[model samples]
Target: IRAVGTGQDALGEVTIRVREGSRIVQGKGLSTDVIEASARAYVDVLNRLASGHARSSADSAERELAQGGVARP
Candidate 1:
């Protein structure tokens, strides 16, 4: 969730769900200053996604070279 407002005003917050294994991110901006808040939230989700990708790639490579590796069909 990300939000920007003079906050005590009537501005509503924006909420979004981030998906893994895909880069199609999305969002919404409710208040007049929504752009700033939306950008911040997008960046935060992107950073987390980047880190997850790095970890999964490292793990996959390690398994590829592991001893007695499972044979593929």
Candidate 2:
């Protein structure tokens, strides 16, 4: 149903479900602009669940790239 909502209409709602241990976070948004709703849902997920892992991984990657990695002038 959620995929159908996001895929088949210019205006519809989207929901994302994420769970870990006993914790669950769900988000929903509706918009005539599909990108807007998608962004909203993704932001919600990142805020609720994805913040730490993604930031740590991104920081690790940045550190690797900064460590005299191959570079172009």
Candidate 3:
């Protein structure tokens, strides 16, 4: 993560990058408050990770069920 003062209305520009294996995700946030900008950048990465996990888990579950796997109670 990197942040820089944009020198415009006391705003800040933040760049966030996340890497998982061969997958890479990037996000940018700009705000008059530096903290807010940082938080936004972090949340963006977190949301992406959560979304990927949910999708992958669902796909795996479907594959398992299709292969005659049982769903435990």
Model 1 poorest 10 in a row by lDDT: 19-28
Q: Mind giving the per-residue lDDT tens digits that candidate 1 earns over 1-73?
A: 4434554664645655454553333334455455655665676667656665423433544554685565221
Candidate 1: segments with Cα more than 4 A from true spot: 1-12, 22-32, 53-73
Q: Please write out the lDDT profile of model 3 over residues 1-73, one tens digit for every residue.
A: 3435445566677877666654455566778887888889888878877787423444545665899996321
Candidate with the larger lDDT of 1 and 3: 3
TM-score of 1: 0.37
Best model per lDDT? 3
Pairs that clash in candidate 3: none
Q: Name model 2 segments beyond 4 Å from true.
A: 1-10, 48-73
Q: Is candidate 1 or 2 superior in lDDT?
A: 2
Q: For each predicted model, how many residue pairs clash, with residues at least 3 apart or on different chains?
A: 0, 0, 0
RMSD of each: 11.5, 11.2, 12.4
Predicted candidate 2 versus true structure: per-residue lDDT over 1-73, tens digit per residue: 1433344464656776555554455566667766777778777767867554323334434554899664221
- Tell me the TM-score of model 3: 0.52
lDDT of 3: 0.65
The stretch of ten residues in a row with the least summed lDDT in candidate 2 is 52-61
